[model samples]
Target: MHVAVLGAGYAGLSTARRLESRLPPEVDLTVVNDGPDHVLVHEVHRAVRRPAVADAITIPLSDVLDRATVVDARVESVDAEAGRADLDAGETLSWEYGALCLGSETAYYGIDGLSERATPLKSLSDAAAIRERFLALCDAGGGQVVVGGAGLSGVQVAGELTALAEERGLAVPDDIEVVLVEQLEEVAPNFPANFRRAVREELTDRGVDVRTGTTVERVTDGGVETDAGPLAYDQLVWTGGITGDDATGGDRPTVRADLRLTDRTFALGDAARAVDADGEPVPASASAAIRMGKTAAENVGRLVDHELNGSADEFDPRLERYRFDVPGWLVSVGDGAVAQIGPTVLRGTAARASKTTVGAGYLTSVGAVHNAVNLAEEELL
Candidate 1:
């Protein structure tokens, strides 16, 4: 009569909250994660320009969870079959039902010197470091800043860097040499055509050099080694690849249709290779993770009820599967942004508003109204 959820990211938080609302009062629940507060991973990029935004984007776990034990400890691994999770501090937690929603980390791809040379944008500390280092470079007479990804995060980081340079009166594209390198031929490979074009235009307008169809082969202290050639840069950031950290999160284990790695143990989010009703692999994104987390929570609740009732029947509860849907896409680039919500594609004020609304909506859903309101005020004002 217990359910344990791991990590406090989008998937874990959503699952825990939904479980609290659905599970019976007798059931004990525990949430194990590495941190006390939930971070808005997407908003971490903006902290580069507005450092105070880091505070507004994080909410203490106790501020949201109503009835659950929140364990702020690093989980080493989960023996799903054994129903036990090992912690980094030589402790183990046992559970009847569990959900593994530990998120992803940067993938350095075994490229020589890349891990040591390239900075990653996977955490709040990464963003904060970028902010600090970028300013330091500016004060040291500014040089080339190369971003090794043209994805949403990379575009946003490049945009923020561009704005920060302009704010500090650093040279636009010349002295800074802010370049966004993408392996694909387009800026946003998976986005709509119009949105892709819009992002490219915005980067161009913001004086960011956009290099398409370029592959980064290695990283050096001086710059990135790519298929094109050695591109000189003072600071290099990698935002292109992501993979599950197996030691922290579980390995990408095969899960049953109900997302069960073992009986009473479920795996969701980036840590699991999840599929939908049609058996197609679901892509990892915050939106997908949130939806999958709720589904997993509901299924876990059903299993708990079956166990407590001690049903004589087969006790095969019908489980819900995640249905993939493009719930729209929004990318904010400094003062402007572009969004494609359903059939509508927008830019400028409409897009910026849409982006802000999505962010505020996420914060509101997690019961961080004060932080949401303050973020809005800080962003707008």
Candidate 2:
């Protein structure tokens, strides 16, 4: 029996690792993805200004997988019913069991020129480009820096940009603003109100010009055109929203309740539209993706054995459903401060510690135990 898992993001990597340790030795497994490294997505916001962080946040796939073939390829599409995947290199491979773990892409919410003008923070390359752009703007002297979408990404970018400006000794005139524009009244809307308040206060205290309850009409080369007005900027970083990228991930034909796409195929992570026990759609986050990946891996193990047993009993597709409770949110607010946890919020150095601990916990959970420890050391020191 053989299985193929697509993507190397949160969902894909966790599922592959689970199978590597759980699947029978006779079963062959392969993990296919475009990148050579697994990006720690939650840390990507910090990586926008700190290039070295990209290295720490990404781990080589070879070092993490012991019993799976890691294929580095840009996936084009998958014929789920046919159990075959086509790659950008004009090669197609067939698998008995295939899993789709393709993650999401930066979502531009129909804002004119936003996609064309703003730099998104969803990928390592995107983060690096933001850093380079900021540096270039600094070298050119100084000007306003505006951030669109005051979500977690926006707040982090604003904080990091402020810090970077100081480090580079760039003149940030009082009139030359560092602004964050959000459509919502509150910042970090995903978190609780208390946490949101803490985050707002922190950003305000850190010298960020917060513009809540504001709508962006478009993004221009100079700056974002908002309902308020056209604000000038030398550089802009967009930590806006996200949307599904079907070009790389497979389109949904029909996903079984057991998490399988076809007889031997599966889909997990942001790429998979998994319905929970209540039939409610799961929120797209790293937490949900990690859980889905583990469940898919377990079901894959069962299918591998079932194939070998040859009992002729059809696979019980419903055995693949997974439901769990996990609600922990954390956001960095510059100056070594953070807002975190569920309803309970932390601030100052204590909040920062919580944020660091949470990051370490994720790395360890994803089977990068040593990397988790190393990252903690680097982050703390």
Top candidate on lDDT is 1
Per-model clash counts, in order, read 0, 2
lDDT of 2 by residue, 1-381 (tens): 678888888889889999998888888888888978898887887776667666667888987888899889987887777878888779887787777888877778788888888888888788788888887778777678888888777888888887777778864445335789888888887666887888888888878899998888887678677888888878777777766666544343334346766666787676766767666666567877788888889888777777777853875534567774466666776555665565677788887888888888887776677778877776687
Q: What is the lDDT, from 0 to 100, of the residue 369 in candidate 1? A: 97
Give all candidates' CA lDDT scores.
0.85, 0.77
- Writing each residue's lDDT as its tens digit, candidate 1 over 1-381 gives 678998888889999999999899999999998989998887889998998998889999999998999999998887777788888879899999999888888877788888888789978889888988899999988899999889888999999999999888888877687989999999978677888998899889889999999999987789688999889988888888777766544256656457877886888877777877778777667777788888889989988888788862775678877776757889888888888888777888988888888888899989899998978876777
Indicate which candidate wins on TM-score.
Answer: 1
Indicate the TM-score of model 1: 0.95
RMSD of candidate 2 to the true fold? 2.7
Off by over 4 Å in 2: 170-176, 246-263, 311-317, 365-370
Candidate 1 pairs with clashing backbones? none
List of clashing residue pairs for candidate 2 = 97-264, 98-266
Candidate 1 residue-wise lDDT at 221:
80
